[model samples]
Each structure stands twice: as structure tokens, then as C-alpha cells.
Target: MSPIANAFSIDVEDWFQVSAFAPYIDRAHWHSLPCRVERNVDLLLGMLAEQEASATFFTLGWIAERYPMLVRRIVDAGHELASHGYEHHRASDQTPAEFRADLVKARDILEQTGGCPVIGYRAPSFSIGAGNLWAHDVLLETGHRYSSSVYPVVHDHYGMPDAPRFPWRTGDGLLEIPVTTVRWGGRNWPIGGGGYFRLLPYNVSAWGLRRVNAVDQRPAIVYFHPWEFDPEQPRVDSANAKTRFRHYLNLHRTEPRIRRLLREFRWQRVDQAFSDELEKACAS
Candidate 1:
């Protein structure tokens, strides 16, 4: 703990809605899938309460539409409510108009269900990169104050290696707070929470975040999903070996690792953790 309250976030989507499963799990069948989000989220909430920690939940409009109470529970528990778009479609794959529509639909549903204005957005799969820089302007126009949608690392699925690792003010004045990464051997490597957290040892994740906080002197932003906490989540057997490995590896360790992280680090909602940068973005 570097005496900095790092930003902690949860992308509120079910296991079936993950991008890796998109090839197999049809959106049409999403409604039919047994949703474990509510239960898993409750489990997370209980742990957070035990640790007396707060986080930001980037919820889906589709989930909010069906589980309004879940949205309310997040708000009622003293966490910030934000949007993760209408569905799990990546912003990079959609036209600007489509992105705008998805963004608005998600924000509106989140505001209504959570009873608070949503100012933060995280593109599904960390999807807004160089090709979709235009998405930031749409976020500005749509009243989003900030985004944690960019990952400044090299990955097969998503990344923009040259992007700034810390929170940056976009041309549109929307603060773009990227997921945390650490620079070593002239490359940006992801240490931000997600599958990477599950794939790697807990000490490695802690070391990366500590380095970012100590060297970069900036509050690091990390993210996870409710499904990540549920090791028993329905296995997507249809997914390829790599996908299965990525999604299911070390599932049992995730909860305890998160618990240790909470105990060791000073975590806060994104808005609170990066308030100064957000204020600067607005002022600019």
C-alpha cells in the first residue's frame, strides 16, 4: 500500500456473456441461461462489506433491465454505478452510431435502475483503441465524465501498446483512465485484474500494482467480473482449450486473492480514486 487508494471495478456481466463465449452462447439464449450474477454479486458484496471496501460496478443495461434490484443493491451498498453498454459487443466492432446507441441505452438503464447519473464507462473487453478513438467523443457528447476502456498492453484480443498507462485527458475532454499496467524490459505488461490476475500468482499481481503506485506515482485502476469470483460458474465446454484455460484457470484462488488484495491495498471507487484527474478533464 503506497498510501494511494487504487480504483477497483467490477464489469457486471454474467459468465455466458463473456466475449470468448460469444461464438457459442447466442445473445438470444442469454435470457434463458441461469444467471449467477445476482448470487455472485451478493457474495462479492458480502466480502466487500467484511473488508469495508468500495468499488465501481460497470453494469450492463441488459442485466439492469432484468435485475433492477441488483443494480439497486450496488448503489445501496455505497459503491458507484456505471455503464458497460447495452450488451457485451465490443465498441471497436461497432459503427459510431451503434456505439452511441449502445452507450446511451446502457447509461439510461443504469441511471434509472441505480437511481444515479452514470459518469464512467468501460468498453466491453477494453474495446476502445486507436481505430475507435471516436468513441471518446461520443462519450463526451453523451455526458460520460470518464472511461477505463483502454488497456495499454499488447494482447491478441485487445490492447493499444503505445497508449498512456495512466489516466489521460482525451481530446474530447473525457478522462480516459486505462487499466493498470507496468513497464518492464521496454514493454507494457498487464497487471490489472481479470483473467491475468487469475492466470498469474497473487504476489506477481501485487508487485505490479505496487510498482505502478510507487514508480508512476498514480493511482492504479484494476477490474474484475462477478463470474471471476465464482469458480463453479457453468463451464463453457464448447469454447476452445485456450479460451477454457483463460476463463477457468485458478478459479478457486480468485476470491482469496481478492480478499488479500483488499486487506493489503487501499481500494476506492474509480470516481473517488481519480477525482483530481476527472476534475482536470472537466476543467479542460
Candidate 2:
């Protein structure tokens, strides 16, 4: 039997732009900060090339505008280029018009810069939840084909705990491929990626993902950021202790662990890994 091919993705944003540091790092100052995303993403690209793996990159339009060559490099390497909004704003925080404009701007920039049609999106911080289900309608209207913007686990930051654990189509025919989670103790536990991938022991995260494939028989979606690979990135001194801990903890170990994950499991771009589900969504 073939191994379950899981989706591996990267959220392409810099160190200072993380939502946790929003209060401390003003958006106005973002241009003044030292940008490490290019180098970090290059490092990831090299690693993926060595491992013979491919991934979908949910890149910020802000980054793509400033670094078109980086965007081209991702496309040239056979990865999907999708949006993470224009400025990393939360979908729930924006009006429908604002959300629509953001997606349009992002898709336009990504498609122009990468020379590929942008059809997938992952909201900044996974910000699309029950309150902003209208965001899905905007996505379909804006020409996006799928989204990995919802997480089913309950969390302090963002999640819709009641949402389905795997790929499901919205009323507008846009497929919502949520980040992977495992059902345990009568609730969904986050097992896919982001800081959880760092906080949990590598074996524990692996165990959860293995269970999702072995038992649930579904493709798992795992995500991380270019910033997570840069432990030497500048720090936000004013960030609270908990925020600081969550962002910086285990940064040095991220590369090795992700390399291990790439070797241990079959991985592919989200579009390819879940093509059948996405096709069904379009057909329906």
C-alpha cells in the first residue's frame, strides 16, 4: 500500500510580522526592521530540494511585492504560491469588503509575481472562523479555489472547534482544507503544525500525525513559517513573556525536526495531496 501523502506548507512571513508581536511591533515600523525572510526561505528551499520534497507557500502579498524574485523562485521550484493576505490582518477583524479587497490584492500580486494562477489561500494566523464564514464567499468570488485557513482545535488565538477535521466544501464551492487535528478525549487536539510542532516532543507530534493517517485515513495538512527557521532573528523586547515563549521556544530545533518529518512521511503540495477532494468540491 502507498503511504498516505500529507500536505506540507510554509506560511511566508518575516520575524517581526507575527500576530503575537503586533502590539509591540507597530506595522508602521515594519519597513524599518531588518528582513530575514528571504534568507530563511532560501534555506528552506535548499532543504526541501535535498529531501526531494515540495510544498505550498502561503505567502504575504506584502513580501511578494518587495521580493518578486523570491516569489518566482518558489514557483520555479514547482511549489504552489498562495496568499496570506496583503498585510497579515485577521479576517474576522475586517469587513466583507475589506476581506474581499485583501484577497484580490494578494491574489493579483501573487499571480503577477509568480506567473502562476493563485487559487489557494491560508488566512493570517488562521483567522477565518465561524463569525467570518462570509470570508469563504469572498474567496470563491475572488477566484480562490481552496483555503487552509481554519483549524478545528480550540485555542486561545484562533480555531473553530466545531468545524470538520478534514477537507470540506463551503456553500460557495470553495474547498476548506483545514489544518489537521486529532480527536482525543472527546475533542480535537491540534497535531498539524505551527508552534505546536515546536512545543511538543517530536515523537508525540509524529504519533498524532501517524494516527490521523493510520486511523482516520486522511491526508494531514502541516504548516510552518520561514521565521521559525531563523533563531537568530531580532527579538521584540516588549512582547509579553508568554508570547515571547511561544514564538521563540525551540527555534533552533525546528530545522532538524522538520527535516526528520520530511524523511519519515510522504509529503506533497496541498493542491496535489488533496486533488480529489478539491475536484469534488468544484464538481458539487
lDDT of each: 0.92, 0.92
Clashing pairs for predicted structure model 2, backbone only: none
Show pairs that collide, candidate 1. Answer: none
TM-score of 2: 0.98
**TM-score of each candidate structure, all chains considered together:** 0.98, 0.98
Off by over 4 Å in 1: none
Error of 2 at 144 (Å): 0.4
RMSD per candidate (Å) reads 0.8, 1.0
Q: Give one digit per residue, the lDDT tens place, for model 1 in 1-284.
A: 57999999999999999998999999999988889999989988888888898999999999999999989999999999999999989999999999999999999899988889999999999999988899999999998999999899999988999999888888779999999998999999889999999999999999999998898888888899999988888888989999999999998999999999989989899999999988888888
In candidate 2, what are the lDDT values of residues 87-131, reduced to their tens digit? 999898899999999999988999999999999999998999988
